[model samples]
Target: MFPIRDHNPSERTPYVTIGLIFANLVMFLLTMPWGLNAEGLWVYGALYAGAVTQGDMMWGLLTHMFLHAGLMHFAGNMLFLWIFGDNLEDQLGHLPFLGFYLICGLAAAAGQISAEPGSTIPMVGASGAIAGVMGGYLLLFPRARVDVLAIIVIIVKVFTLPAWVMLGVWFALQLMGGYTTPGDSGGVAYWAHSGGFVAGALLTLPVLLRKGGSRFWSRTDGHPPHDPIDYGHRSRVPQIPRR
Candidate 1:
């Protein structure tokens, strides 16, 4: 299941979030086969655990957040960013939000490097940073309604759920994967995801406290500070007659 949209909408336009999405798309185009087709781009841009541990290619900590392994990876990460980024930007402001995103990305790289310092795998993608955005969103608006599309084989369903439930499940899966999967196996960077999430939430704690902490939650009722948008749609599934 993946979130399609959320009921919460930011009062101000999220320019930084839009800029990030555009930057990622541009980077994808530059690295794609039809574009530059430069294999060296991955070597230089993607984070290498060994290189970082050795104090070389330190740029990868930030560069890797803009690179992706494939179209699906790019699309999925961008989608999550789009869904969760705006409200955080609204809350954190433009420049601070950008800083928060980069720092979370760095923390994610560190998490992976700590997990597999000797691994030579090149980790790339904005998943870790966007996972941070999800973490922040969960803390600020846990009761916000998010529309999720669940696909199980031929069965399809769309449902609205609290933000806490969706993000909580996602975070749990990352922890489970991090524990179950070998660190050097080189598939999903589960530790990076988990670390970024925790970092994001921790970073957001100051803002939460500034807003009076529990009182803020009481005032907003764990939702956005404004009225939630209503798309006026409900879940539905089509049926097929058996032959």
Candidate 2:
């Protein structure tokens, strides 16, 4: 299941979110040629991306967040950023949100590296940063309803679930995967995802407290400041004539 949207509304335009999406897309296109050649992939990934064993390029911590392994990887990370980053940017303001993103991403890299410091495989993607946004969203809008598309075999359904349930499941999966999968494995950076999320949630705590914390929760009822939107639908099936 993947989130389609959320009922929460932001007070202002999320310039940072849009800018991040644009940057990620541009980087993805620019890096597409690297995927076609094995040597190119290694050369690019090492020079720009972060690896547990590579300590020469200190900038890799930040650059790696912009690099992606493939098209689907780019799309998935950007989609999460689009869905959750806006509200966070609204809450933290443009500059603060940018700082928060980079910090979480840096933390994510550290987390992954800590999991296997001797591994040489390069880790790339914005998922760790995006996971931070999800963590913040959960803290700010636990009760907010998120529209999700669920597919089971041949059946397709849309369900509106509370943000806590949706994000909790995602976080849980990351934790489970982080523990079960060896960090030396060259694949998903589960530890980064889990670590970034925790950092995001905790980092936003002070902001939430200043907003009144429990009182804020009471006022918004753990949702957005506005009334929830109606996502109901009328059946599309043609009606049969009644006897």
Candidate 3:
């Protein structure tokens, strides 16, 4: 499901979120070439995927969050960040947002490494960290409406769903996938997705609590300060005659 923009709006642009997305894309492009496999494609995950077991390149725990394998990988990640990260930046401010994003990314890498303490495969991409942003979005704006583009077979549908349902389902899938496909050597670090999400949600708790917590939700009616906008359809399915 590709997320559509939220109906709620923020007072300020999510500058830090946009900058981080750009930074990740630029970093991936810069390092992607050097990490290509024999097939002349990028696969150098170790540059960011930590080698924690061997006690080396501890920095990859943080670096890995900015690295990605291909254009699709980078694009998908940045897209999500674009959709959901702004409100978070609005809440956390600039430096705090930067720190929060890094922490989530590093925590994501650490989760994958913990799952495969001795594996040599390098994990790459900003997905896990982005997952954190999604998690944080869930808490900050649970009632905010998200427009999702859903495609199946030859049919496409778009709708605005509650944030809890969208993110909740995504989080559930990660957990199931993590357990079902525990393949450290093969890539697709599901654990990182799972871990980063947990970290992001948990880490942001204190901030949520300080901001009047339940009271904030009560005051705002679980919505952001602005009203949602309707997204015109993105499809043109030909209408059929009445059967």
Candidate 4:
């Protein structure tokens, strides 16, 4: 299952979010195999736990967030950013939101470095940072409705779920993956994802408190402050029947 959209809408344009997406896309294209000196760029941009722990190539902590291993990785991270970023950007404002994003990303890098300080494999992608955005979105709008597309064999279905359920499940999976898989095996940076998520939520607590905390939840009913967008359709999807 993957989240496709949300009912929550931002009251203003999410300029920072759009800019982030565009920047990531440009970076991806620049780092593509056929692009200019892709190998050299990856060497300079990708994060390596060993390099960081040894006080070398420390810049990867920030640069790695803009790098992706492949097309699918870039697409997935961008999609998540697009879906949940606007709401947080709306709440935090553009410059602050941008700072929050980078801070969360740094925290994610720290998490990964802590997990495998001696590993030499390079870590790439915006997932750890986008995971932070999801974290903030969950804290701010736990009850907001999100549209998820679930595929089962030949059956395709779209369903609406509360933000907590969707994000909660995603977080749980990350924790599970973190524990089950070895950190230096060079796969998903589960620790970074979980760490960034937790950091994002904790970071967003101040904003939540300033908004009247529980009173704010009561006023907005755990949703966005503005009116929700109605897609004017049900969650059912056209599916082919089995023989």
Candidate 5:
């Protein structure tokens, strides 16, 4: 299942979310035409991970977060970012929000690298960062409604669900996936997922603390200060018709 969007639109536009989606796309296109093969991807990964290259590319650890493996990888990351990032940016404002995202992503990589420091596999995708965004969303607005698209065979259904339930389930799956997997650096980076979430929650704690978090909850009543907007028309995930 994929989330098309949320039923509750933020009172403000999500500039960071849109920018992140475009940035990932542009980076992917830069690497895609080179075939993104083992050698190519490895090179990109090394450069992105800030490995000990002949020259300085130490910043790749941050840059690599924006690179993706393929269309689906990019799409999935973008979907979550789109669903969850805007509200975060809305709440945290621009620079701090960006900082939180990068910090969470780096923390995620730190966890993955700790698990596989010597492995020569290249990590790509904004999932770690996006997972962080999901993390923050769960904490800030647990009860907000998101539109989910569920598909089974030819049957398709769309519905609005509380953010806590959807994000909570996804977070649990990541934890489970992290435990069940073989800590395979070559496959899904479940550690990144597990780590990113922990980072996001921890990172957001400061803000919650400053705002008298429990008091903030009491003040805002666990939702945003603004009224929940209404959606006159339901949105469906735009299916890609196969050729």
Candidate 6:
């Protein structure tokens, strides 16, 4: 299951979120050939992407977020960012949101490294950073509705759920993944996701408190300050009577 959109609308344009999406896309284009070639991916990953290597910790912490193992990796991260990031940018503003994002990304990298300190595998992608965005969204708008598309077997279903339920389930899955999958084991970075989420929630706590803590929730009733936008309306296909 993946989020398709949110009911909450941003008060202002989410420039930072858009910029971030653009940057990730640009980076992917720049590194497209490397992603397409296995050997190239290794070389690019080793030199630039962050890895928990025995050698001195390099610039990968900063660079790794821009790299992705494949197109799906990049697309998935971008999708989450698009779906959840605007509200964060609305709450945190542009520059602060950018800072929060970087900090969460750093925390995410640290979380991964901590999980496997000696692994030479390069951890790439924006999953960790976007996970942070999800965390912030959970804390800020637990009652807001999110639209999710789930595919079970051959059936496709679209459901609307509260932000807490959506994000809570996502976090739980990450925790499970972290336990079952070894860190830096050439798959998902469950630790990074969990870590970034924690960091995002903690970092957003002060902001939430500043907004009057419980009062904020009470005032907004845990929903967005504005009315939810209904994006689920389906156009009916016209039927012609048999002639």
Q: What does candidate 6's lDDT look like per residue over 1-243, in tens digits?
A: 988888999989999999999988877876777543444533454322234454454667767777776788989899999989999999999999999999999899888877777666767888888889999999989999998899999999999999999999999999999899855576788888999999999999999999999999999999997898988567698877998
Each candidate's lDDT (Cα)? 0.93, 0.84, 0.78, 0.92, 0.77, 0.84
Candidate 4 total steric clashes: 0
Preferred candidate (lDDT higher): 4 or 5: 4
Residue-level error in angstroms, candidate 3, position 120: 1.3
Model 1 per-residue lDDT at 84: 94
TM-score of every model?
0.94, 0.88, 0.86, 0.94, 0.84, 0.89
Per-residue C-alpha lDDT of model 3 across residues 1-243, encoded as one tens digit per residue: 778678766678788887888887667756665543232223433433335767777767766677777788888888888888888888888889889988898888778877777777767788888888888888878989988899999989988888999999998988888888856556678888988899889977887898899998898777885666656665688888998
lDDT of 1 by residue, 1-243 (tens): 999999999989999999999999998988989878876787699999998888999899999999998898999999899999999999999999999999999888888888999889999999999888888999999999999999999999989999999999999999999999976998999989998999999999999999999999999999899999999856687666999
Per-prediction RMSD in angstroms?
A: 5.5, 4.0, 5.4, 5.4, 7.5, 4.4
For every model shown, the clashing-pair count is 0, 0, 3, 0, 1, 0
lDDT tens digits by residue: candidate 5, 1-41:
76778755676777777887888877777677555444454
Pairs with steric clashes in candidate 1? none
Displacement of the residue 184 alpha carbon in candidate 3, Å: 2.0
Worst lDDT 10-window in candidate 3: 36-45
Model 5 bad stretches (over 4 Å): 34-42, 46-57, 234-243
